[model samples]
Target: MTSPVAGAVAAPASRRPAVALLGAYAVSLVGSRLSMVALPLFVLLTTGSATRTGLVAMAETAPYALSTALAGPVTDRVGTRRVSIASDVASALVVGAIPLLHATGHLTFTALLVLCALAGTCRGPGDGAKYVMIPTVARAAGMPVERGIAFADGTSRAASVLGPLGAAALVGLVGAAGALTADAASFLVAAVVVAVGVPAAVAAIGPAELDADDPDAAGSYRARLASGARFVRRDGLLRSIVGMVSVTNLLDAAYGGVLLAVWATRQGGGAPLVGVVAATMSAGAVIGALTAAAVGHRLPRRATFGWGFFLVGAPRFVVLALDVPLPVVLVVLFVGGLGAGTLNPILGAVEVERIPEHLRARVLSLMGSLAFALIPFGGLVGGLLSDHLGVRTALLVCGAVYLVATTLPALRPEWRELDAGRRRAAEVPAPGSAPAPAGAR
Candidate 1:
């Protein structure tokens, strides 16, 4: 299972320093994922209101947009390892507060939202650090940049793919608060792991030419912001990638936003079946993630992304349209999940390799934010379409939109260069880079 991903290629298994740092990063990501699963489940059980569920989801999401937007620059200014550790420690405190508040019997829903929002703020920086740190670790380990990215992506998939069910099991055994306690514990573990492990890989001196400490590094905060803007704007490869992925995000959000409820209702399966659907999707994605790791680094990143999107996108329509039993649905969903699983890690590796270390966090955050920016819109659209347009019709519309979005980048000549990113060094920066600094580019 030793795939050729662009990561710590220093010594196969002999690179102890690199391995330690990567291990710490992986642990931190997994710990964060575990908390992500526990938080929502805890909320649902305490108050079985879908409205509240949606609201909580929104609270978490709003902060993600805001935090994700800024995390990149902050990560660039401070060391990613330090930020990762600090955020995890902060996250631990926030998640731990939930149980503490509940224990003291003052855990109002509004208070819960505020706490979740605070924790939500940490997610962006923490996420940005991982992206920013990967290449540094890969370079330290002498691993291929692609392999480094693949390893990171693979670990994230493995950690997150299993988080929710584990949360549910904990809830069943010790109640939601207990699950929250464990979530808090995971954060602490992650913080400790990063502190002890990641420094070796990340402690290297970065290029001062890109240093935020240089008052002349850029200009105003707005100018610094624009640097990333211009990079993304002018980079044909980045533009194509972001456009296609953004579309996929929108369509997936549409279906995911409403699929469980709609499918259960259509299939005459109850609310519990929603859990079954989610589990099936997760299982499928886990399988896909593993498969992607097997083939991702060996193949061209662009090809992997395109084929994977095809796999992830095409079957979704056919599967959702079926009236088969839950078992059958699960099987097809797993197959579909395989494609879905391939997306994040492969592209994540590509972006890391293409961008500079100092700008790594900002570029990754901007790209992720754009790709996922439409989730809320998709969710709302799905809900509305299902209510007024029928589930099957909604599914059809989503599928069409997905296809259109994923393929849109292929239409332009400059974007065609994206397929050649592995061979091409040139990029057209995003207009947003102008906000970073006047002379940034």
Candidate 2:
């Protein structure tokens, strides 16, 4: 007999619900994008210590890695939709406290760090839950998986532009504290949208344990998490993707969190300049995302994904190392953002294509956790390096590190497995289906 979750996944997909999901995602991202700029800026401005800024960044992201494990079980139990809404609500409360404490003069440096970490912990599962819902959303909307993921990625990039611009304007008018308050409000609003707007059939799937029809779905939380990890380990392409992303994310976090802010401050740009720099990159990302969403299906996944990494990774560091004028740096960031934008859509498509439906949440949680594991250390190290080695030397070294990391996937034999696996995936029928023809595409 078909399980209810299976029935839900098998429902006729529609564009309206998909649009609603995207809308919710976009709203949540607006807040996320604002915090990305405001929180780090807050630490840098208030503390005037690169190390302290790094500590704040570290505090926020460290829980993200650990919280993924916790998120998987909860998502599998409560359903992705409910989990997402609840997480957002919790995030709203946590993030809103920052401004409240600041106004009351009770917000200490340590308190800020703790609150940031609390928010990160809330975000990890919320993000994972939303990710898990994508496949179901695609199925319900009758949308192609690649198209759905591309839209998701594109929406995020677009928000990156708006969020920074809005945050910058808010900072000018009311300070970073005020921008953070706006961030909190965004989360609450996003929760309401997701809860009310998303279709019930697409929103919740109950506990995975009840889905006897799903081979990969049964098991205790630990076993389920381990199963996902094992699949990643055994799959060459997945393993390579996870490994490369882990290193690249670590390096990128440093640049995005500490390096960029410090560079702007030293260059005499201040907080608004920091927002401008971020917005420029995000604008490029929007273009890249739209292009990918339109034509990504025709592109060779390996070449486009790998080369995109090089453009995004190498240029930012090199330009910073050169100490070029701000305009020149902005141009490089724009180009790099274009390349960066193509990456997640490809990765999202590949992930959804490879993992079993039942294992989406668990595998995604593991993947996110593993990918972000080094991020905290990256920010901490970047800050210390900037302090000890100076920003120029740090950029050169980190840029070189990024160059090495991005280049590896192109040459690695395992990376080729991505295409090979795609072909194999195309040949196999989806769950509960008869086998495909011998040479199905």
Candidate 3:
């Protein structure tokens, strides 16, 4: 649905792209975290094996990878708004199917896996669109992409905090399948936000020669794909940044999945412990979002991004695995979230800034695929490690790995390039967009 574009939307753009980007994403996460909580609970309640929950996780991740890989050109060709609206609805329908099937006694592992795959598929394309939208809006509004994306990432973290907590409550009250229905409802809500809340502002069409750098013009989709892949391979900063983020993501997924719950179980906190831990991290993440909103622009994004990995990664094990009290763990997570707040949007800005529009989706997808590819393995390995070495030991081991993965990238000269590529002096306003002078921040 197209609407008349409005004046720089800080005051009028429904959700304010920079902030709306974050808020809308936050709302989406509400659905995701709720599902994350509900799916496992449903499987556990129905089948009595915690391991069964991994199937749902697998389903979601598989499609996430596939869609991410394929969706980039779609983001560039069709524009982010259309892709976002369509994907959100598709995701809503898939999530809705879960509760529908449960009601009819048709819910089965096979069914759940299929649905999760569908959602993942939608999410990949949707995420690509969302990333494209962020820069487009920020450039239009004369705001830096970093602030907007950071705000968006932090908002996402806030939802991460709330969604699981809501899921836990809903699951406790209405049972897990019922929570799935609510999760489905959130996607519809997300669709509404993307379709209506976001301003339909397209990236400016420069002259044909100006558009010569278009990555998709390789004559065929497969060739375009190769072009994008080749571009990334040739870029030192982009490649290294992707590697660092990917490793960071892998470790985070491995350790952070049911992290607090595992620890709580060890310490004799039963079924409810998992929700509490998730909530703690969520709360930390929300606080982190606010912090990002407050300071994202002023800080050096490359450094901020690295520190974010350090904060959330290194401390996860240290704070949770220790023999400290539960309240103490909550505080640590809250502080850790502050770091989480800055990591995503900064990197998002970095990724978008360095790449041409044509390669955006492919690079983003490849990065996501590489980074998250091993999460399942991380889970499998983590689960086994937790079983034998104690959850605390597993967490500590993850923390040590986090240090190694995150540090290599942080120390690289390429990080300096990201800073140099988009300085205030050299900032290239998206073609046709008017931006404020160097003093805006």
Please name the candidate that would achieve the greatest TM-score relative to the true structure: 3
Model 2 TM-score, 2 decimals: 0.82
Whole-model Cα lDDT of every candidate shown, in order: 0.70, 0.80, 0.72
lDDT of 3 by residue, 1-441 (tens): 122442233344433644555455767778888888798888888878766777777778888987887776656556667778788789889988987888889988788878888899998888767766776666655566776776667666666767877987998899888998888887777778766667665332232522487735645777766776787889988788767767766677666565555777778986677667666777777667667666676777667777777778787678777778888877777677778777776777777777766567667767766666776676667777788887888888888888888887778777787577568434654444356566964
* Clashing residue pairs in candidate 3 (N, C-alpha, C atoms within 3 angstroms): 22-152, 72-361, 161-282, 284-334
Q: If ranked by lDDT, best first, what sequence of candidates would result?
A: 2, 3, 1
User: Model 3, stretches more than 4 Å misplaced?
Assistant: 1-23, 45-52, 106-109, 172-174, 203-212, 270-277, 319-330, 387-393, 424-426, 430-441
TM-score of model number 1: 0.84
Q: Once superposed on the true structure, which residue ranges of model 2 sit more than 4 Å away at CA?
A: 1-13, 36-58, 97-115, 171-179, 204-210, 213-218, 261-275, 323-328, 383-393, 425-441
Best by lDDT: 2
Error of 2 at 253 (Å): 2.4
What TM-score does each of the candidates earn? 0.84, 0.82, 0.85
